[model samples]
Target: MTATTHTRHDPAAATLLRFATAGSVDDGKSTLVGRLLHDSKSVLVDQLEAVEAASRRRGQDVPDLALLTDGLRAEREQGITIDVAYRYFATPRRRFILADTPGHVQYTRNMVTGASTADLTVVLVDARNGVVEQTRRHAAVSALLRVPRLVLAVNKMDLVGYDEAVFAAVADEFTGYARRLGTADVVAIPLSALEGDNVVAPSAHTDWYSGPTLMEHLEGVEVAAGSPDAPARFPVQYVIRPQSGAHRDYRGYAGRLASGVLRPGDTVTVLPSGQRATVAGIDVLGTPASAARATQSVTVRLAEDVDVSRGDLIAAGAAPRLTRDVTATVCHLHERPLRTGDKVLLKHTTRTVRAVVREITYRTDVDTLERRDAAGALDVNDLGRVVLRTAEPLALDDYADNRRTGAFLLIDPADGTTRSAGLVGETSAWGAP
Candidate 1:
C-alpha cells in the first residue's frame, strides 16, 4: 500500500514459517502463544521471571503464560488483545514469525493486517464453547486472504476432561465450515494452553488423539508447496546508476522477485512501456549471482539500455494484464466510510496512482457470508466489492492466482492515509463490465 506499511519479511530463508494466531475473546490465544514460546524454551529466563512476578502481583497462583504475551499495559489490565503483537522464535529445524492478532469483532481490521502474509493461520477455539460467530468470521477471513494453510487448536481440553468426543465434534464442525469457504486442507489439534498440553510437546492426557503437536506440525508444514509454477514477475522498486564511479555506466533494476525465477541472458520485458531487454547480470546484494528465485531480492543489469523506473514491472512472459478499470474486494479499515464517487490513490506493487470509486456493489455480512445490497457507505472493518477507475493503467493479476501481483492498497489522496487493502477479483461474484 502507498501509505500503508507492509511487514518486513526476513530475507529469503530456506526454511521459515510465517504464521498468524487468531481466535474469539477468551479463547486463550495469548496463552496459547505464550505456551508455544515457553514450552519450546524460546522465552528467556528473565522474561519468564517477569511473567511470574506479574502473575504473583495479580494474585494468581501459577505463572500466567498469557502474561508472556498481552504486552500492552491496557491489554494486561483488561486481559484482551487490542492490537497485533508480532513475535519471532525459532527451533533447530525451522524459523518462525508469529503475528498474534486480536479477537474482538471491531478489531477485524487488525486480524487482516496480521494474517495478510501468513503462510499458515492458527485459529484457536475453546472446547467448552463450540464453533462461534467470531471463529467463523476469522476462518472466512483466512480463506479470503488466501492463506495457504489453516489450523484449529481446540484449547482448554483439560476443562473438558480431554475427551476425544468433544475435540472431534468441534474439529469436525470447523473443518466443514472452512471447507465451504474453499479451505480444503484444515488441520485440528486438541490442547490446553494454560496447562501446557499438546502445544510444543505431546500431552499424556490425549492418548486417543494421535497427531503431531502444534510445534511439530508447524516445523514440518510446507510453506511454499502452494505456489504454482509461473513465469518470473519482478516489480522495479529502484533504478541504480552510479554517478561518478567506474560502474557509472552500470544500470540495474532492484526489487524483490514476486514470482518465478530469473537468470543471466534471460529475455525480459519492461511493462507499462513494453521495452525488450536481456539480463546481462544478476546482483544479489552486491554479489554476482547466476540466478535468483521468487521472494529473493536482487538487482538485474539488462544487456541493453532500457527505460525503467520505480512503479514499473519487469517480466519474462507476456506480462500481467494491464487495465484501467478494476473491480476488487476491499476491507475498509478506518472510521471514515468509503462511498461511491470517492477519489483515492491506488497503490499496487511499487506504483501509486489516482483512482475513483465507480460504484459500490455489495458488502459482505461476515457472520452470515451473505452479500447485502449497496450500503451507501462502508463502515470500518466492512468487506465489500467495488469498481474502481484509475487514471493510469495497472499491471494486475487475480488475487486467487497470485497474491503478490493481485493485491493492492487504497490510499486517501488528501492525507496519504491507507484506507483499505484490496484484492483484485474473487472466484465468484462481482459483475464488472
Candidate 2:
C-alpha cells in the first residue's frame, strides 16, 4: 500500500513513456492524474500548498486535486478543462510525459492532437457510469490514432463500494468494445483517485482486484521505440548547401526520416521527380552515423546531386506511392463546414500544396460509429471521408500501415488556420481513415 521510490537513473538509460488521459466529463480524469502525481510524490510542496490555498479560498474541506492540472484561469473558474495539459514525472522504471486532454465533446480536436503521438492512452471510466457514449467516443479516437497500448482505469471504485462485480462488468463491456474498435491490448485497473487508492500503490479496499496498480501497468507496458512498420520516408524539410563551408559544394538533404531505416549505401528515389541516387553519407544530430532509423533527424548526402527541395520526399524503394489524388479521412476541426470544391492547403510531412476537395463521401458519427451520408459538407468536429486533388504529386502511404507518412493536415487557404486532421486511405467503421 506504499508508493514505489525512484532509484538513481542515468539519464541516457531511462525510457520515456508518453501517455495521455481521456474520458467523459466528470470522469475524474484530472483528479486521477493529480492522484498519480501526488501519490507518487511528483508534486512539489509549493504546488501542493498552492492547491490547498486555492481550495481554502473556494471553501472546501479537501484540496481540489484537479487544480494541479487544470492550470488555466478559465478552467479553474468554470470547473472544466479546455486545452491539453502536459505533465512530466519520472519513476525508477521510466520517465513519463502525461497529456491531460479535455473531455468535453467540443474539444475532441484537442484530444486528437494529444493522442496522435502518445505511446499509450489511459482512459478513465467512472465506476458508476459503465461504458458511456463519451467513453466509447474516446476509445474510438484512440483506435483511430493507432495508439499502441491502452489502460482502462476504472476510477471512483470507492464510490461503488469497491465491488468486484461492478468493476468486472465495466471492464468486460469495455474490453469487448475496445477489441471491436481494433485496439490491440487493454489493461484494466480499479482505483479511487480522490482517496489515492490503487493509483501509485496497491489498494487494500479492493483486494479482489489482483491486477497491477495504475502506476505498475503504466511503467510495465511495452511501447514501440520508434520502430518502422513501413518503407523509409524522409521528407525534405530543408536543403542544406553551404557556399564556402568545407571546401564548398556540399548538398545535403535535411529532414527527419518519417518511417523505415536509411543507411549510407541505400539507394533513395526523389519523389515527383523520380530521380535515383545512392546515399553517400549521413549525419545524425551532428554525429556521423552509418545509418539512421525512423524518427531520427539527420542530414543525408546523396552520391549524385539530384534536384531535390523542401517539398520533395526522398523515399527508399518502390513502396511509397506518388499521386496527385488522395483519398483520405478527415476529422474536421473548424466551425466552418468543409464542402466539396473548397480550396484548401494540404500539409503532409514537410510539404504544403494547394488542393481542392474533390468529393465528400460520408461522415462517421463518433458516438454511434455510423457512416452517415455526407451532406456535401463536414461540420465542426465531424469525422468524414473525402477525396482531395493537389496541384503536385505527393508520396503517401496508407495510414494504417504507417502513421507518419499517411497523416496530413488540411489548412484554410485564406487565413492559414488548420481546418482538419487527415489520414490517408480508407478508415474503419470507427473513423480511423
Candidate 3:
C-alpha cells in the first residue's frame, strides 16, 4: 500500500499578523517599534550594544531605542527614517511581521508599500502635538488600503506629564477623524516610547485608564480569517506538463488561490475563454490534497483538456467581471508623473498587458479628504483616480470585496519600473465618482 502524505495546515500559523507603523516627523514611530521589539525580547545583545555605542557617540546617557529600527546609515545620521524597515518577532500568543514606515511626506509612497499587505496599522501621534495634518494623512492612507484594524498610539506621554486629559483629547480627535474616514476599528492607547510607559507593561501613571497595554491589544486582536463563502479565484501562473515522463499525459494549472477554498469535483470556469471544467485533483507540493484554501499555492488538474494558459483565471462560485476598460484608484509611486494618454503596462495577478492611461480623474487631498480635478497628472506619492484601457480583457473583483484579485500595478514599459499601485473601485471618504 502506498502511503499518501497530506499537507497539514496549522491553525496556530493563522495567528501570524502583518502590521505597519506610520507617523509624522518626530512622532517616535521608530522608537515605539524599537520599544516593542526590546520589551518583547526580540532584540539581540549585539544589536543593543551597537545602539548603545551609537547613542554614546551622540553624547546621550541612555541608548536610543530608535536606532534599532533606523537601519539605514543616512537615517541614523539625519535622525529620521528615510525608508521602510521590516522586522519579524513572535510571542507565545502570536507572531508578527512589522513594517516600520517613514514619516517624511516625500516618503509617503514607502508607507503605501508597507501598509498595502498589513492587517493592522499603528498611526503614531505626539501627545503634545495632538492630531496634526500628517496624522490625518496616515489615517487616510490606512483607510484607503482597507486595513482591518487601527491603533492610535498617542506617543510622548511622559513629555506631556503623563496627563490623562491630554491623551483623552488626542484620542477623541483622532478617533472622530478616523470614523469620518470609514475606519471603525480604531484602538487608541497613550504611551511614552522613550520612558517605556504602557507599551509592553501597563503604566501606573494613568490611574483612570483601564484599557489593555499596546502588547496586550496586539496579541489579542482578531486577525481576519477570510470567509469560506467567498468565490475561489486562481489566476493561472504556469501550466505544468511533462512531455517525457510517467506523468506525460498529466496537465495541471499551477497558482495560488487568491480567495476562498478549492476542492476536487468543484466546477470552475476559465475566464477570457469562458470554458467550463471540473477540478479533477488538487496537489500541494507534489502531495495530493483534498482542499486548498486562499493564499495556498497548489496545482489543479482539470477533468477536461481545456485551453487555459497563464493569465487566465479559473473561478468557482461568483464570477469576476471581464472588461478591457478599468476605472481605478491609484497611488503614484515613481518620480515620473502619470499623465493622460500615456502608454504603460498594467500587471494584474500573474498577467501583464499593455494599457493606456485614458484619463487622470482627480487627485485626493489627504488632509481635507477633498478630490481635486484640476491636476492633469499624478505626481509622486499622489493618491488619485484614473481610467485605463487595456489591450486584453481582465477578470477583476472589486477592491473593497477582495483585496487580492482587486489590486494591480502600472509599470513603465520603457524601464519596467513600477509607477503606481491601483485598486479596482472608488476609495474615498466623500464617495465621489
Candidate 4:
C-alpha cells in the first residue's frame, strides 16, 4: 500500500500527531512514556541526570522513569500525575505530542480535558493485575471520546518473567472489554516500561511476540488523510483585512477547515444565510496552497462579498445540519450534577448557544453498561443520554461521523467553566425516566 503524503509546514518533517496515555495507579503509564522518549534519544543529558538524581534521593538503583513525567512538586510528593503534562519529541520518522494524564477517580475530569484533542490513545495495563476497573474506565472514556486508534501496552513483563501466558491473558481480557466500548483497533504489546523493552527498539526477550514495537507501530499507523471533495465546513474565526497598501482588497475569512478539501474556483456557500460565492484563493501563513484539507489553518478568499462573520460555517457543495435541537450522550465532569431543565451553553466547534436540558435519559452504569432509571441526573463520572434544545441552529455532524464536528463541550453559563463533554447519538432510548 502506498503511504499517503501529508503536507507539512516544513517539507523536512512528515506530520505531527497528538496522543494521550491512561491507566491505573502503578500501572506504569508515566514510565512507559518516559521510556519511549528516552529510548528514542529525545531526552537531553541534563534531563537524564536530573531523573537519575531524583531516583537516588528515593533510594533506587535504576532511575525511576515515572519521575520524568510527573514533574510538578505536588505530583511528585503524591507519587502521581495530577495535571496533564504535554511532552514533545521527534524521531527521524515522525514528530509527536504526548499528553500524560492522571489515573485516580477524582481526576477523571483532567483526563478528559487532556484527551479531548488526541487522535489516538495508549491505555497502559499492569500485567500482574490484568483488566482492572481503572483499565475499564479509561477504555470507556476513549470510546466516549471516539478516539480513532487504541494501543494496549501491557507493562511490567519483567516482574512476570516475560511470560507469554501472562501477556496473552491480560491482552485477551483488556481487548474483550475494550471491544464493548466501541474501540476500532486494539494492538497488544507486552513490555517492561522500566527496562526499555519493546518501546523504541525491538525486544529480543519477546521472541514469542511477533508484532511491531510500540514506536514502530506508532510511526507506521495510517491516520486519516484529508478529504478533497467532501462538503466544506469552515467555522469563521475572525475576518482578516490587512488594510496595508500591499493588500487593501484582502478580505480573508480566517478559520481551520472542519471537513472536506477546498481549492480555488470552487463554488461555496455561507450557512445560516444561504449566501453563495466562489473561492478566489487560499492563504496559509501568508502563502497560498493549490488546495487545503481538513484541520489545516487557512484564510479563504471569496470572489464576491457575502454577509460572512465569525461562528458562521462556510461550506462547499452541501451545507451541514443546522438546528437548535441536539440529542447527545454526555459524561458529566463537574462536582455538580447536570439535571433536567438546567440551561447551559453548548459550544460546538466555533458556535456557542444557550441549550436547555430537555430530558435526562438513562444514566449508564459504567461497570455493567446497564441503564439505571433511579438517578435523577448525572453526577461526576456518570454517563447519560441528554436531550438539549439550543437557542439557534448549529452546523453539526454525528459523533460517529466526524469527531471534530460531532463532539461538543457544555459550559456553565454562570461561571464560564466547562461542565460536561458530549457526543452526538440517539438519546431517546438511553434517557432516564
Q: Give the top-scoring candidate (lDDT).
A: 3
What is the descending lDDT order? 3, 1, 2, 4
lDDT of 1 at 363: 89
Better of 1 and 2 by lDDT: 1
Top-TM-score structure, candidate number: 3
What's the TM-score of every candidate structure?
0.93, 0.92, 0.93, 0.90
Model 3 agreement with the true structure over 140-204: per-residue lDDT tens digits: 89899899788889999989888988988888888888888898788888899998888999998
Query: Least lDDT summed over 10 consecutive residues: which range in candidate 1?
Result: 1-10
* Each model's Cα RMSD: 5.8, 4.0, 6.8, 4.4
lDDT by residue (tens digit), candidate 2, 103-184: 8888778888888889999999999998998898899988888887788889999999999889889988888888888885
**Cα-based lDDT for every prediction:** 0.85, 0.85, 0.87, 0.80
Whole-model alpha-carbon lDDT for candidate 1: 0.85
Q: Which candidate model has the greater TM-score, 2 or 4?
A: 2
Q: List the lowest-lDDT window of 10 residues for candidate 4.
A: 1-10
